[model samples]
Target: MSETSAGRAPEDAAGPAAPAGPPGAPAATLPYEAIRAIPVRHYGRWAAAVVVVALLGALAYGFSQGKIIWNTVGTKLFDHTVVTGVWHTVLISVCAMAMGLVLGVLFAVMRLSKNPVTGAVAWAYIWFFRGTPVYVQLLMWFNLSLIFQTINLMPFYKNDTVAVMTPFVAALLGLGLNEGAYMAEIVRAGIQSVDPGQTEAAHALGMTGAKTMRRIVLPQAMRVIIPPTGNEFINMLKTSSLVSVVQYSELLRATSDIGISSNAIMEMYFVASVWYLVLTSVFSVGQFYLERRFARGSQRSLPQTPWQKVRTNLTTLRRPKVAR
Candidate 1:
């Protein structure tokens, strides 16, 4: 009995052994199962996509049934007169924008000046130009000869108002002056957006008012100024169409002439629209790049270009999915 007890004590000290499997069999292990998470189905998003696609299809079908002469549009799209008109439109828009920019900067400075006289003058100029319709201004400019027989600067130059106020000059003044009033407000807003501390710093550095404005403030303010300025320029391009009323041959006027002669007014209108779209799209791309360039110090990461966006999307689409 003593020998049997001693042998049991060793077994007790060792504790209960695990149950054995079949002879020579490997230890059993629970197989690892990865969690298969099912994504939530967005039925609402799918429904919205279907609705949008259906609406687009219906619109396309409707336009397809319209009486648009596509051949006429194609034929006259690149006609010599149409091309010339496009050139003139671009020229006038550029000239007017340049004039507006100069006047805007000048008046914007005046509007912010300490002098009551200068500020009032600037305010009055802006108020009058902004208040009047651009069409009326154009007509007034065109018919200036009726009011003043001559434009005289006795010491330097003098001319008959009719001769000096050609259709081109009249259109330029009308468009440019009106644009300046709008641009002045834009420039002033941009200038004000800059930190007052920046100006104080410039003053501390012994920079004169003019130098500080030109060298320090304007550069910084450009970030705010560029976006709206680009939009205004694009608008100017479209507004140049109104010059046709004054007999200045621009894209719209040229197209109208061709339309009258060819008896395809609607087609010409379509062609003009296409050209305008093309011009606007091209300028839009330029504006995007310009804005990106000015965004350097403001943003840690600049917005991606259209090409970069496309590449990123494609890469995401092509990436391999891990097996569940």
Candidate 2:
């Protein structure tokens, strides 16, 4: 090795090679822009998407062209009888859901109670309601007078059995109570989703249990709660048809009556399906906005609006190509 004047080696004479460039900078090389951003075209994914779209389009075209009876569907769709049925469906759904929400919150709290008796009662309620078919429950409620000849409430009413158990009352009780059981579980899950630390912090700040729950925990839990609750509402809307078995004139029953009278069975059923689809679509859109509203603190960033997403896609498509 070559020696310096102070007996150092030749590499020592170069003074540690001057570190190339800045400390974290990569080493310089030819084809300086080699680290380029190239859009990856996943041919398999693109092909699959195209195939799925084609299949859906074909199915839609087939459905439109298939001849059962379009005239009957159009005529029955906006009939006064059908419209009345729609209103009844909406009323029952709203009333049942209101009852369910109230009872669900109550039972969920009971289930979480420190008392074993309360917890057991809540558990049994959920178990019995959830275990049985809703159809059976509805049937039993409609025919409840067989078991109870007189429903007596002296202070509240005249102890009359007939007034207490009409088809409407039975339907309401059946739909609402069963829904309460399901909703209880849903609410319990949402409550559990909230961080225990938040509750503890609220306690530390001297808030009452109810106050903390109402102010902090429930607000947070709603992010988890709202989606499933919306789904339940949609399910309830469909489930209202079950009341038709008891001669309640809901949408399906009315449509069925029309079909039987006019001899356009399939067409009237199709009209009911269309109306149901339209209602569900409306609910879905509402649910989406409700979810977005509640997702504020939980999500790191809000989801993009459809228009924003479309604009982004358009910008990407219009981007100038980079030359190799």
Cα lDDT tens digits, model 2, 1-324, are 233446666564444333357789985542335556687777897799899999999998998898777877887799999999998888888899999989998999899889999999999999999999888988898887788777766787554555677777777988999999999999999999989999999999999999998999888888888999999999999999999977788899999999999899889899889989988888888888899899887789988766688999899766467667
Off by over 4 Å in 2: 1-39, 61-65, 306-324
**TM-scores of all models?**
0.86, 0.82
The per-model lDDT (C-alpha) reads 0.91, 0.86
Candidate 1: tens digits of C-alpha lDDT, residues 1-324: 112335554333444333458999885543458866665567897799899999999998997789988889999999999999999999999999999999999999999999999999999999999999999999999999999999999989999998999889999999999999999999999999999999999999999999999999999999999999999999999999999877899999999999999899999998899999999999999999999999998999999999999999898656355449
- The true-versus-predicted C-alpha distance at residue 322 of model 1, in Å, is 5.0
Best by TM-score: 1
lDDT of 2: 0.86
Give the Å shift of residue 53 in candidate 1: 3.0
Inter-residue clash pairs, candidate 2 = none
Per candidate, the number of residue pairs that clash is 0, 0
lDDT of 2 at 207: 100
- After superposition on all C-alphas, the RMSD of every candidate to the true structure, in Å, is 8.9, 6.4
